[model samples]
Target: MKALVKTEPGPGHVELVDIPEPACRPDIGVKIEVKYTGICGTDLHVLHDTFKNYPPVTLGHEFSGVVVEVGSEVRRVKSGDRVAVNPSTAVVCGTCEYCLQGYYMFCPIRRGMGHGVNGAFTKYVAVREDQVYKLPDHVTLEEAALAEPLACAVQAIEELTDLHAGDVVLLSGPGPIGMLCLQLLAAKGCRVIVAGTSQDRLRLDMALRLGASLAVDVTAEDLQQIVLRETGGIGVDAAVECAGAGPSVLACLNAVKRLGRHIQVGIIGKEVTLPFDTILYKQLQVVGTLAHSQKTWVRVIKLLNQQKLPLTDTITHKLPLSRWQEAFDLCERKQGLKVFLSYDE
Candidate 1:
């Protein structure tokens, strides 16, 4: 099977190569034929060697596929059923204190799929059946590929924060994740504000159409004051930092109201210098999240089924699996919102 292997960690180290096809074993896991895979910012960070990551890795986590073969115990999913996977993997003793409290992300046995194991960047991947969720018939395979990221976004917005209706939200960055944040906030009846540079005009426009009350170029003159004035001399009720840039982190801090909530969703390549004094003075709550929990993936599927969150609007590019490099390049160059590599018929 063909796969993009990251033999080295640095810019452009990801290579297209052929590898063994995934096999199903009764006591092991189910085999899935990957239909579409989405490249994420973490994949880019691994490529740039900005963070600690395993080498010789298959570098895709956001993906969806169809069941090709099932393990003996994998009655949850069967062959021919389309599905999406949540990439966060954790093993619990079930007797552990944390597992008893249902806080498994902190489990010592926690291991991410793409980081700790071979991920979904190949023609086929074998994963635990418990990690898979059946796709809605209305959701195309390409859109199903968004479930992983969507689960993360949903967890960040719904579970990780104490948001309320009529609160003002400043979403920094017009990337796919940021755009998804905008829509999710809007859905909750928040007055969503989107911020990005002038180059993100198209994305900003899309944000407004998706329910953002205001989308502004943060680089514009007097933008900070404009935000302050719009919020009636107070900053926004919450801010989501999705830009993953040092300056953007500071911007999110400066945009939040006193004691406001800030969800850090983006991956910063280096140590970010932040205004701790400002955060302290305002009594701000800053939180960071990794991948989503199993519960969150279920919520994402429900949202997709009810048409509450339309991920398709943010999907701007799709290429064949053979052109994985091209799809990855577009994401690295920031030329498109979301790019998918399709492998199935």
Candidate 2:
């Protein structure tokens, strides 16, 4: 089997290598033949060594595939079943309090796919059966590949953040995660102001098309002015930061009303200088979130099955696994949106 492996530590250490096919452990493993694996921002972090990822591991977590084989103990799925995976449960201390609460990402010894263990950037991946989620009848494999990020969005917006219908929101960065978060906010009936830099012209436009009330090019136009205009000088009810940039963070802090919710969904790999006093003076309800929960995945799957969001437009680039570098380049350049790597011959 050919897999995209991060062979060693440091930047640019990844390569396409021929490795032995994975075997399903009889008790709890499920071997899947991957169809479409979407490139996530975290994968870029791993490739740059800014994020923690064990070397000699495959590098993908957002994927949809067909079950080729299932372990003896697996009862949820069987051969030929189409499914998506919840990578956060790849390796966890099942007895921990967090796992028991369905928040597997916080399990003391949790190791997610793509970072801790081998992921789905190849022909076949054998994950714990518990991580496999059967795709709904109406969900295409391409759409299912995005369930991971959508689940993360659900966790950030619906679960972790406090937002109400008709509230004005400031959504920073129009990346894949940010865009998905936009959809969730739209569904909640929130009036969204999507912000991005000049480079994000394409993404910002897509955000408006996806139901955002306004799309501000922060680099050219003033974001704070627009926020005040939309919210009648009261600032937005909530601000979701997904750009991972220091300026975007400051913008969110500045645009959100005093005592409003400020949710951080982007992973800023390094610490950057910010106005720490703002959070204190504003008395804001600030929350930082990461990784999806079991319940959130369930909600995302339901949303997809119900055909509530038109997610196909977000998928702008598709390349075969052999063209992994090109796919990475596309993401790095912020060319379009979600980039999918396929396993087609």
Candidate 3:
């Protein structure tokens, strides 16, 4: 089995090597044949050694595939069933305080699929049966691969913020997560303003096509002034920071109105000084969420099924596992939104 292994934390350390294929642990979990896997921003960070994790681990969390073999206790799925893998917390003790409250990610012993254990970047992945979800018959494997990041965006916007209809939403980024947030907020009937640098024009255009009220070039527009003027000298009702850049985070904070909600979805690699006074003086509600919950996945899939959001455009590049390097380069160059690696022959 060919799997991209991270030998060490440096440029070009990732290599495609023929490794032993994962075996089905029927007593413990199910083995899946990965059909398609999407490379996420986190995967890039992991490759760059910026986001530290277990060494020598497989490098993918967003993937979709077919059930090859099921564990003994896994009765919900069988061989040949299409599925999407949700690489979130696994083996949560239901009795724990966080687990009891349904905050699985907060569980002290929570183990994620890709970060803590082997992920879907290989020919086969053995995951807990509970973490697998059936992909809709109408959905393609490529679309199923998006469930992870889209679920994150859904959780960031729907669960973390208190947004009202007709309220303005200022999204400061045009990456996949940011574009997804733009679509989700527009579906909620909010006026969405997507702000990004000139380099992000392609993604911003896609956001506008999805439903954003306006797409402002960060270099050309006074984003804060535009938001304030559009909101009748007030400001946007909510601001979502989806770019993991210090300036984007600052812009989001500045665009949000007084007493407004701000959701920080981006993961800035390092600490940086921020304007705490604005938050305090305006009585702003600043919040942050790590990853998606199971409940959020359900809602995000539902939104996809309803045809209210079109995610296919975000998938601009598709390549085979052999071209993994090119895929990484494309993502790093910001040439596309989501790049899917086809693991199936």
Instruction: Score each candidate by Cα lDDT.
Output: 0.80, 0.90, 0.82
Using lDDT, give the best candidate's number.
2
- TM-score, one value per model: 0.92, 0.97, 0.95
Q: Per-residue CA lDDT of candidate 2, range 94-126, in tens?
A: 898888989888898988889899998999998
Query: By the lDDT metric, which is better: model 1 or model 3?
Result: 3
**Candidate 1: global Cα-lDDT?**
0.80
Ranking by TM-score: 2, 3, 1
lDDT score at residue 262, model 3, on the 0-100 scale = 84
lDDT of 3 by residue, 183-276 (tens): 7888789999998998887887888888999999989888888887899998888888988889998888888888988899988889888988
Model 1 earns a TM-score of 0.92
The lowest-lDDT stretch of 10 consecutive residues in candidate 1 is 90-99
Cα-based lDDT at residue 93, candidate 2: 85
Q: After superposition, how far is residue 207 of candidate 3 from its true place, in Å?
A: 1.6
